[model samples]
Target: MATNSTPKKPAADAPAEETAETVTKSAPARPARKSAPGPDVVGPALPAGAEPISVTLAHHHTIDGTDYPPSAKLLVSPDYAQRLRAQGYATPA
Candidate 1:
């Protein structure tokens, strides 16, 4: 009688399957800028032929009960009044 000499083989294992999902991200939003006067705010009101006027903050005097301190005024062109409106400045009465 002849004996078997072949080596025994291990059982085959089942293969595993995998699934993947992709994700996307967006950049953060930027903050808004505030509208305010600054040191660089000094400039003429408007171009030529636009208007010849100026703007200044309201001031009052004790003696004559009149507006003074013209330095506080913002020398602007006539149309600058419109710009002031956009800037939320009240129109003079």
Candidate 2:
């Protein structure tokens, strides 16, 4: 009968083992980023008629898959702009 007492060693080709906690701890934390300001489209007042007019958003909106951030200027129909203004969601640009 024979006995082996020597502790087994990792192979040279084996990669270093890391636990999830250790990996997470070693990773650098990322800081929160502020969204960049949207474009300024505020233009001259529209002539008195039924047409699209620019309005500044008071709240965020997602329309037709496009995101409209607060304070962003958007061109909308007169009726729609009126509705938004009445709801306090937008103001004339």
Q: Can you write out model 2's per-residue Cα lDDT over 1-93, one digit (the tens) per residue? A: 989999998899997788787776665666554443344322234557757677888998655445668987777677677878898889644
- Lowest summed lDDT across 10 adjacent residues in model 1 is found at 59-68
Residue 10 error for model 2, in Å?
Answer: 54
Task: Please give the RMSD of candidate 1 to the true structure.
Answer: 18.1
lDDT of 2: 0.67
User: What tens digits encode model 1's per-residue C-alpha lDDT throughout 22-66?
Assistant: 234457776554333433223443675664455554442111222
Clashing pairs in 2: none
Residue 35 C-alpha lDDT in model 1:
37
Count of clashing residue pairs in every prediction:
5, 0
